[model samples]
Target chain A: MPQLKAKSLEMRTPQVTKTAVLVIGGAEDKVHGREILRTFFGRAGASNGYITIIPSASREPAIIGGRYTRIFEEMGAKKVEILDIRERDQCESAETKASLEACSGVFLTGGDQLRLCGVLADTPAMEIIRQRVRAGQLTLAGTSAGAAVMGHHMIAGGGSGETPKRSLVDMATGLGFIPEVIVDQHFHNRNRMGRLISAIAAHPDRLGIGIDEDTCAMFERDGWLQAMGKGSVTIVDPTEVTHTNEPHVGASEPLTVHNLRLHILSHGDRFHLYQRTVLPAVHRISS
Target chain B: MPQLKAKSLEMRTPQVTKTAVLVIGGAEDKVHGREILRTFFGRAGASNGYITIIPSASREPAIIGGRYTRIFEEMGAKKVEILDIRERDQCESAETKASLEACSGVFLTGGDQLRLCGVLADTPAMEIIRQRVRAGQLTLAGTSAGAAVMGHHMIAGGGSGETPKRSLVDMATGLGFIPEVIVDQHFHNRNRMGRLISAIAAHPDRLGIGIDEDTCAMFERDGWLQAMGKGSVTIVDPTEVTHTNEPHVGASEPLTVHNLRLHILSHGDRFHLYQRTVLPAVHRISS
Candidate 1:
């Protein structure tokens, strides 16, 4: 059923996504500037924000949940709740749905992506969160594995430090938070270019966005993506791919792809996802 | 179209797979013993065998193709032809079709699984190969990347040192020579248990077969798989899996799966593919 829904979503003519999603690569600055987290806190209405932290993905849910709760509380958020979901059935509880409905912002913590999806996929709590985000009634942010689950075609796991080969990247169904794109977190630091390229080679229709550690690729409702934090976001656009030896080569062998468009964006740079173009950064006036 | 075909193949009630397929892990003892290759040669009718070596997966197609051709010829094969397919269009040619139709056995060499697929997938030559294979007219044996591409759900590449996380395995569409199982070559030698397990977690319906170096998982028309060579064939059966936190965890986090039945088969051991049971090896009286 999700596959059918995804197909229909893909078939629909391009429209600006109403949801604002902040996708952070792994190891985001928690102690330093906290520019990314601070940006997310402000976007969620700051003091008026009612935040929900979903730490099911982490092995130490309480610790991870408490960590983020304190961070948001220190930032002066109005209210924050830790949704400790241990089992799939817990997601259907009325209390869980209610918490999601009342929240202005939701944060997904880092852990195993498969575990996160195992508990939340197809659950009513996740459904409500998705509906609210789509309606532009909520702001959502996720880090590390949280960021990896935002696409339809997820790069679940794969090898790095190798040539881009069909065997280098592992893919699984994703949460479809941003269906038009495929994302990889902790990109450059892990030397994950080969895997990402391998992923894009398999799915040329989707835009490949690789977020480096400590970086965030923030998606706005207006369809422009803004880069924030210290690192950069690398985009691999395969629209012009004339030929690819992806299917021709064997595992561990190098892949050959022609004419892939690449773009690297740092803080303040913006990219239009649908248009597949980088927009010139305009000077902002501080009020 | 291939997806539809694959789905239809999957939907069919499990019947005894008539095609005899030899799936070898990488680095099978090519120089000595050569038990695996010799078995394939014998299955193809030994001295009367008309063989076609497909080295399209290798970068040096000519050299790899010649190596197999000589090996087969030295074993007293009736004839051997190296099908040097460099382009997709070549698969549609009459010469290509004729050569495939004429061969009693087909040997796909190792290089890059993606490259092998790019040239052969959905092509007329490949279709003939499949038709013959299904009709039990041809014996097919592939090693390394060749072995990887025999299944419908192919493990293209992935990381090994890490735990079995959803992010550790990369999968792609394979040639479907044996769609019922997913194969990974050079298994324990490369510490690929994690990737293979991750692959099975994603596709619970398919049996996960990990062939070790110098090993082979031979599928007979009778539907029983016999292990050959020095190393063992590890089978990860997910049919009894009651629970998995694969979808619940985030990327890089260890996955939790319960009730997986595992069997490691060595030389002469046989396993029933569909029934999900190990068959006792019968003593053979030498002629």
Candidate 2:
């Protein structure tokens, strides 16, 4: 009989490839243009990594896609390619595949999340994107719409901020680059509190991150997220909130939210993503 | 300085209203049809209570709006009023105002959440609904789509499961009958886990209730919710989840969900919506 490897032994081996993620708030292009770009290049390891930009996100306008290409080039990136995925066919193009395969860093610019998802769903590019991330060859970064698409579920904006109704926004399948978290940009500035709150109340098990403009949260390989840039990131963890008396009542009933922990993190704050808790001071980056 | 008046204290006193929320999971006009009809009558009460049904909700055969009116009459409701809200003028008709003012309960039948919000937004009927709820004179009950419209924020339906990127579902403002919670019905049957999870993840502080078919969780005045009817209710409390590293990586990033407390409550299980923990058995309702 052949000797069998124990499952525990197999689990002990470290997975190759180091992955880093950068989430820039919607207005990052205007505020921390150079700094955000520098962070991406530095994280990607200037000499070893190639960069690919998905500009289809420009449909939302708030996301400045081409800006990253120019910035990355200026930062001494010899090979910078932009994949203009306007139609579904382009997402499967040979050029798109080549660029994605060669790149160590994939950047998604801000725009319309729905548009981006529509262009990339179930395509060869999507599979490649997932494979590269898993292989640790790619570090995915997004700003605004780009960042929103990084989540498995992306928010498609709709309705007003007045009520916490399900009709206030639209949700679509995102790139599935990150599972179980919903991403919202320009969170505090736009008073997206109602929408974000509704989102969490809808799915209590998932986590939400509302990155303020000019701020970024970097998710390292080990499920750790470190807050970087100006302003603060709001971590809404509803895992403990209880006692919801809602949609069944016809009249507006007072909703009681209990045991919600809100963490406001500025630059240098470190959080363990799976643990959903703030890390100790030792883990935080010195500004 | 103004003297603190006794009347001020009285004004701020918490007024307790006898409100009953009837949640119908499946076949509002067929299965448990009599019970649903009786639900409307119960809301009307013996005194000056009126019942108004919005027909616009039943444009689709599955909605069964007119059936509610017939059931209300069969259940001995003295006054059963049908308000056609499709016409812009009808939203502010004298009949609509009188029906709202004279009635103790307003029945919102099953239909589309988007349609309900669209018809009710900025309307006199909408204002009356809000006033009645605040006055504690209304017991709002909904089935299916009607139930979806009870919360301040409503879910219009979206994607196949929860992956974090936006699903195809849309969220809009609802009647605001219930604040702070997002309600989803036929949760398990329709596999709405992803949508509900997405909603809660976006708003970590709000509570999410996924009521399975034939099951209902009623939020009482004391800030407690009692599960009733057949099947079970899934309460998702994300407050204790440890790590939520989102917006930092690609869609393939493994989600780490730690310490999320999920409660599966059957009939007569009383959950405290505020505390987010299971209350002792002594506080539970005697079924």
Candidate 3:
């Protein structure tokens, strides 16, 4: 009876979004194979796609915006526009909202997360993007600082290569594009396990996703996250944690935690977000 | 008129405790000159003192507890007792409470802070020690992990050598011996400036005090903290901070903070805790 109800619900929602969010860690290869970018290009509908680039996070928005525009255009995007919304007021403009409305995909470039948030947060353009993404009308992707802002609870900056503790990372609000997890980019390359673990300890309800340099954790509308690129994606699940000293202990004390689940996913590996289960890659049976 | 009132109060209280809290960083000279320990011994009333050493933080309590006992005995302390309580139940014992009550001075040795808190926090002996220290009836000194637990907000453990952000260190509730500040031991020797700054950013209300190796920051009853020994004490005061991204940014995000007051005090230099002022060392009049 439950299966029948779920099947009916799924049938009713025929327009379910299949496009995924490409969350690339910093330092992704752009010149060579460009596998991640190529994947994004195909997912965004190639020649039929109208891609918009938001480079507000960079110090030189034009340079970064032009870079992505060329990359997407070279990959056969029909229309590529650089929104370059430098000011917060620009985010409220009709032209900005129209650009986003027409965009099949949006790419947020890397630079300073605080700058990105300063320009995009709480504006009409951002609201429209959020709504469209939720409605399966747009595919969104960000890299480096861009990837860091995908989660509702963002890791702005903090130190790495230490024991996992409350004082190991700094946190702030993000764009809320993906609200269920806290994302940390340039993971293992920068030794950010301690930072991610500390973040998870602070917000146990949210999963901690640490993406290594050149890696991507693509989240699909069906709630399955797939790992891509050369490096791996680290998932820290705090749901099974039996005990944590976070509440009783003060701000900077070493933590005592028990039963945290961790998973390292490489290319082609898939994980169901809600179910908290991993799906190993299926090997091709060559006859 | 205010001065007259203060004088009157002072006249009424002739037995004001002259003892100070000797907060030593890790690796104080145990064999060499023993300058810091000797200072502590004299302030603890030398030959007339009944000093109690708490070595619960150490894995081998008896070894560490005996080491300090011998040091004090060598320094001519007539009475020295090792109250090495390993269990929480032992902290509640009558003997533990009696030892703390009879002692004129209490010394906490270096070890694992988590273990120390597990054994001592909320126990009968801990409560007695807190009350006595507050009432100025007992002199208190701690080193390394001992010094780490002096504040209401204690830094348990975290990384170093990074930008000052919210996640650079871990904090937990300390013994609250000195409630107004957050203490970090083995400061400059370990390149912990960033760690201390992060701690201050998280807790602007509490001053971040970083004590270097073989150094001591002694807090007197009059609210003056004096630096002693070879290295300097870095005091980070967050009261002047005009802006901080801590409230808005997510966990691990790089923080943007402005106008934090910092002071580095060497041997003989003093800082007024409540006033948030620094007093330079007084040169000797050799005439």
Q: For candidate 2, lDDT tens digit of each residue in B7-95?
A: 78878995443666655554433445344445446545723445777655557533455676666666666677777687556779888
Best prediction by TM-score: 3
**Tens-digit per-residue lDDT, A138-191, candidate 2:** 888888888888777777784332334354456777787777678788765565
The iRMS of the candidates, in order, is 18.6, 13.3, 17.0
Where is model 3 chain A poorest over a 10-residue stretch in terms of lDDT?
A: A278-287
For each candidate, the DockQ is 0.01, 0.02, 0.02
Report, in order, each candidate's fnat.
0.00, 0.00, 0.00
At residue A20, give the lDDT of candidate 2.
79
Candidate 2 Cα misplacement greater than 4 A, ranges: A1-17, A29-33, A60-65, A246-257, A280-287, B1-287
Candidate scoring better on lDDT of 2 and 3:
3
CAPRI grade of model 3 = incorrect
Worst 10 residues of 2 chain B by lDDT: B249-258
lDDT of 3 by residue, A1-287 (tens): 99999999988874433467889988888888888887777677667888998998999998888888888888888999999888999988889988998888899999999899988998899999899888888888999999999999999998753334567789999998999989999876676766786788889899988887777888888898887876667777888765555756566544444445655565666778898877654541110
Instruction: Go through the candidates in order and give each one's C-alpha lDDT.
Output: 0.80, 0.65, 0.80
